[model samples]
Target: MSEVDEYLRFFPYDEPYDNQGEAMDRIHTSLERGQDVLFEGACGTGKTLSALVPALEYARDAGKAVVITTDVHQQMRQFVQEARAITRQEPIRSVVFKGKASMCHIDVGYEECQVLRDNTRELVDARQEEAQLRERERQLLSDAQDGEERAVEARDAVVDELENVAERVQSISSEKNVCEYYKNNLTGNVDEFYEWLFDDVRTPDDVYDFAEARTMCGYELLKEGMEGVDLVVANYHHLLDPMIREQFFRWLGRDPDDVITVFDEAHNVEAAARDHATRTLTEQTLNQALDELEETDDPRTKRAANVLRPYRDALVEVYEDSFGFGERERVGDNWEDVAVANESGRDDLTIEFLQRYEGPGYKSDLEAAVMLGKDLDDQYEEAYKNGETTTRKDCQTLQSAAFVGAWMREGTDEGLHPVVSVRRDQGTDEVYGRAELYTCIPQEVTRELFEEVHATVLMSATLRPFDVTEDVLGLTNPVTMAYGLQFPPENRRTYAVSTPALFSSARDDPQVQEEVGTALHDAVRFTPGNTLVFTPNYAEAERYAQRLRQQGDATVYLDEAGVDANDLRERFTNDDDGVLLTSLWGTLAEGVSFDGDDATTVVVIGVPYPHLDDRAEAVQQAYGKAFDRPGKSDPGWTYAVEIPTVRKTRQALGRVIRSPEDIGVRVLLDERYTQQSRSDMGKYSVRGTFPPEERDEMIDLAPEKLKFAMMNFYQDNGRYDGPPPAP
Candidate 1:
C-alpha cells in the first residue's frame, strides 16, 4: 500500500464516501505542500472526519499540532466525538478549550475573575512573607539573648514591623473577595487529571465535572493539558482576537508556523473578524461613568469627571446636529408624548472635528483624565482586596478613557470608519447616541494570522464563489475546491416557481400577495409531513403567516423575535403536520437539524437581502472602491449583496435534506431565481449562484403547476399514500 493508504487507517469509518475520500486526498496534498485549503463540501459529506483525519496524519509527521476553531460552541462537541473515534484506532490526546467565562466556577465576568485571582495570589504571598518574618524575628531575639551584637541590631530592625506585616496580611486574606477555586488551583495536584485528560478525548463539560470533583479550576487544568495534546478544539475568538490569540499561542508553547489550523464554518470568518475589530462607546456608559465619578470622594476623580463632562456634552451636541432630539407633541385629549424625529442616523467623525477637543489644552486635560481614571480603578481594587466591597464593578471612567485613547491611536486607518449614530434601544425604546469605529475589511483582521500559520483549512457547506472569499479575507494563492451534494438526486425535488416576485417594491401589492399566498397554500397542503416556510425577515414571515392561516387548512406557527426559539422549535417538531414560518436568517435556518420527518418541505419565499442600512451602504462603497476592475462588471453588488443573499437562501433550503436517507422538496418562490437574463427589473439572476448540480436539476414551473410537481414527486418517492389533493 502507498503512504496515503497507510494514513487512511486513521479514518474511523468502515468506508469513506466518494466525496470524503477526494476531500481528504486533496487536503492531505495541500497540507504536505504547506498550502492553505478552501474547501466547500455539502452536508452529509462527513466534513468533520474528512478534514480531521488528514490533518491529524500531517500534523503527526510534520511535528505540528492541529488547532481547530469554530464559530459555534456546539461544534466543539462534534470535534470531541470525532477525536474519540480516532483514538479508538490510535492513541492521540485532544483537549476542548472554552472561554474563561464558561470554564469559571464562580458567577462573574472574565475580567472580574482575573482580579480575584490576582488578589488570591497576593494574599497567599503576603501570608508566607508574614510567617517568614515572624520566624526570623524569633531567631534574632534568641541570638540577641546570646550576646551577639550584630543580632541585637537585626532584632531591632525586625521587631517593630511584625505587627504591621500581620495587619497587611489580614487585609489581603479576605474570603469574600478572593476566588477559592483559583487559590486551590495554585497548589492542587493535577497529576491524575493530566493523565486522565490524555487518556481519552475530554470535552469542556467533562473537564468541568472532573475539576469540580477535585476542587480545582477547569480552565487552568485545560491550559496545563495543552502542552502535550495532539489536537486543540477552541472557539473563533481564541484565534481571531489579538490578545486572546497571543495568550493561546503562549499556552501551546508553539509559534503559529508550527501549528496547522482549521476554521470550521469558515463562512462566518469575515463577519467574526469585523466584529472583533469593531468598538463602540455608548451614551449610557458615559453617563454611568460620570455617576461613578460623582459618587467618589477623590478630588482627582472629581476633576476627571469635570474634564469628561465637556466631551460628553460636545458629543451630545453632535448627535443633535445630526439627528434632532425628541419633540413633545400633543396626543389624545389632555395627553402628550415625546417623539424622536430621527430614530437612527450616522455621520462621519472627521479629524478636524476631533482636533477641536484634542488640541494642546484639551489634550492635556484628556491625559490627566486618563491617569485619574487609572487611579480611581486602583482605589476600587484596593477596596475589593480589603473586603470593603463584596463585588467588583468595572471602572467605567477608565473604559471611556481607554476607548478615547484607542480612537486616537488607530482610528486613522483607511479600513476603519469612525462615525457617530443615534440608536434607540429595542427593549426600552429609549433613544441614545454612540460612537463606533467600524472595521470595513475583514482582511485587516485575518491576513496576518493566515500568513503566519503553517497551513490553514477553511471549510463550510455554503462557501462558494471562491474569489469573493479570497478577496474579502485577503488569502493568498491557495488550493480551492467545491464539492456537490453526495446524496442521490432522485430523493430530492427542487423547483423554482414563477410566482410574483417578493421584491421590496412588490411586497405591499395586494394582488401579488394573493397570488403568492395561493401558491404557498397549495404547496403546503400537498406535503405529507411538517413544512417550513422561510421569509426574508420577521415582518414578512408574520405577514405570510396571517395570509396562510386565512387561506389554508394547515396549522401555522410564526416565529417571533425575542421569544424562546428552542421552545418554539420543540413545539413545531412535535406537530407532524404543522407549517412553521420563520426568517431565512433566523435561528432555524443554519446549524439546525430537521432530519427524518421533521421538515419534509422547505419553501423559501424570497431572496434574503440584507437591509440597506448605513453600514450596508458603507460596505458597498468600500468594496466598489477596493475591487472594481477595468472592464468587468462592478463587484460591489455581487460581493456585498447577491452572493450573501443566495448563501443564506441555500442555508435555509438545506434544512430539509440533512442525510442521504432523508427525502424533501425545496421550492424557490421568486421569479428572479429563474430569470435567464438580467433585465431592467433585476440586474442579476441568482440561479447561477447555486452549485452546478443543483442548478442543473432545478425545474421551473408556473404557480399553478407547483402543486402537481410536488404531488408527483411525493408519489414517485412512494411517500404519498393517497392521490393528489383537489386544486
Candidate 2:
C-alpha cells in the first residue's frame, strides 16, 4: 500500500469519502514537503478526520506532536472523539487543555487563583523544610549517646530547631487562604492520574470530572502530562494569545518547530488574532483604580493615583471631542440614535491626536503609572499575605496602567486604530467614556506564528479566495486546495431571489423589507423542519422577526444581545418548525450544526457586511494603503470588507446541511446576488464573491416564485406532504 493508504488505516472508518481521501493525500504531501496547507472542504467532507489522519501520521513518524486548535468547546469535544477513534487503532496518547478558569475546582477568578497557588506553594515548601529538619533531629538524637557531651549538645540544638519549624508548619497549615486542590496536587503522587490520562484520549470535561473526584487540579495534571502526548487539543487563545502561547509551549516542552499545528475553522483566525491583540481602558476602570488607591495607606500608591486622575480626564476629553457628544442634542427618546448607540457607538480618534494632544503628559504619566502600578501590586500582595484583607480583587490600577502603556507603545502600529466611544448605563442614561486600541490586521499576530511552526493546516468549509487569506494572514507560498460540496447536488437548492437589494440605503424602506419578509415567510412556512434566518445586524433581525411573527405561521425566535444563546438554540432545536432569526457572525451562524431534521432551510436576508463604523472604515483605508496598486480595482475593499462578508454568508449557508444525508434549501433574498454577471461582476457584488461551486448551484427567480420552487424541491425530495402553498 502507498503512504496515503497507510495513513488511511487510522481514519477510524471503513472507507473514506472521496473528498476526505483527496484532502488527506494533499495534506500529507504538504506536510512531507514542509509547507502549510489551506484545505477548503464543504460541510460533508469530513474535515476533522481528513485533517487529523494525515497530521497524526506525519507527526508520529517525524517525532513531532500535533496541536489542534478550535474555535469552540463542541469542536474540541469532536477532536477528542476523533482522537479516541485513532487511539483504538494505535496506542497514541492525546490530551485536551482547557482554560485554567474552567478546569479549576475552586470558584475564584484568575488573580485569586494565582494568589492561592502562590500561598499554597509557600505552605508546601515550609512543610517540606520542617520534615527535613525533623528527620535530621531524629538522626542526631539517635546518634547521641548519654555520655557524649558534644553529640548531646548537637542533638538538643537540632530538637529545638525542629520545634520552631514545626510551629511554622502548623501556622501555615492553619491558614485559610491556600487552595486545597492545588495543595493536594502539589503533595500527592499523580503517576496514576498521568497513566489514566495517557491510557486513552480524554476531553476537558472527562479530565475535570476525574480530577474533581480525586480532589486534584485538572489543569496541573494536563500541564504535567504533556511531555509524551502525541496530540493536543485546545481553544484558539491557547495558541493566539502571546503570553498564553508561551506558557502552552513551555508545557509541551517543544519549540514551534517540533509541532504540527492545525487551525480548524481557520476563517476565524483573523478575528481571533485581532481579538487577542485588542485592548480597552474604560472610565470605570480608572475610577475603580482611584477607589483602590484611596483605600491604600501607602504614599506611593496615592501618588500614582494622583498621576492617573489627570490622565483619565484627558482620555475622557479625547472621547468627548471624538464622539462630539457635547455638540449633539441629547435626544433621549430618539429611536434612531439609540439604535446607533447600541450598534456602533465608537468614533475614530486619530493616532496623531493621541500623539500630539498636550492636555496631559501622555507618555511620561503613563510610564510613571506603570511603575507605580507595579509597586502598588506588590503592596497589595504583601497586605494579602499579612491577612489585612478578607479577599483580594484584581488591581484595576495596574490593569489600567498596563493598557495605557500598551496604547502608548503600539497605538501607531500599522493596522492598529485608536477609537473612543461612550457606553450608556441601562439603569440610568448616564454615559461613560471608553477607549480602545483595535488591531485590524490579523497578520500582526498570525504571521509570526505560522512562520515559526513546523507546518500548519488551516481547514474551513468557507476559507476561499486564497489570495485574500494569504495576504491578510501573511502566509508564505503555501499549498491551497478547494473541494466542491461532497453532498449530492440534488439534495440542495440555492435561489437568489429578485428582491431589491437591502443595502444600507434601502434596508429601512418599507417596500423592500416587506418583499424580503414575505419571501422569508413563505420559505419558513414551506420548509418541513426548522428554518434559520441570518440578517446583517441585530436591528435588521428584529425588524424581520416582527414581520415574520405578524405574517408567518411558524414560531419565530429572535436572538437578542446579552441573551443566553444555548438556551435559544435548545428551544429552536426542540421545535418542529421554528424559525430562528439571528444575524451573521453570531453563535448560530458558525460552529453550529443543524443536522438531521433540525433545520431544513437557511435564509440570508441580505449580504452580511461588516458594520461601516469608524473602525471598519479605518481598516479599509489601511488595507487600501497596504495592498493597493495602480492597476488593481479596490483591493482594499475586496480584502477588508467584501471577502469577509461573503465568508459569513457562506457560513450561514453551511449551517443547515451538515452531512450527505441532510437535505436543505438556501435563499438569498436580494436581487444583487443574482443580478451580477460572472464576466463583469464588480468588487462588491455578493454573487461574484461566492466560490464557484456555490455560484454554480444558485438559481435566480422572482420573489413571488420562491415558495413555489421550495415547494417543488421539498416534494421532489419526498419531504413535502401538504399541497403546494400559494405564492
Tens digits of per-residue lDDT, candidate 2, 337-455, equal 11111123222333333444453456666666677778777877765654465476567888987886776576667777776666665566766667678788878899988888899
Q: Candidate 1's residue-wise lDDT over 658-723, tens digit each?
A: 888999999999887784523534565688778787788888889999998998888889887676
lDDT for residue 230 in candidate 1, whole number 0-100: 81
Cα-based lDDT for every prediction:
0.80, 0.81
In model 1, the Cα lDDT at residue 521 comes to 89
Output the lDDT of residue 117, model 2.
Answer: 79
Give the candidate number with the greatest TM-score.
Answer: 2
TM-score of each: 0.88, 0.89
Clashes of 1: 0
Score candidate 1 by lDDT. Answer: 0.80
lDDT of 1 at 68: 92
Residue runs of model 2 more than 4 Å from their true location after superposition: 145-157, 160-164, 174-176, 291-307, 318-362, 385-395, 425-430, 561-564, 675-681
Off by over 4 Å in 1: 123-171, 174-176, 292-307, 318-361, 382-389, 405-413, 419-430, 675-682
Which whole-number lDDT from 0 to 100 does residue 431 have in model 2? 65
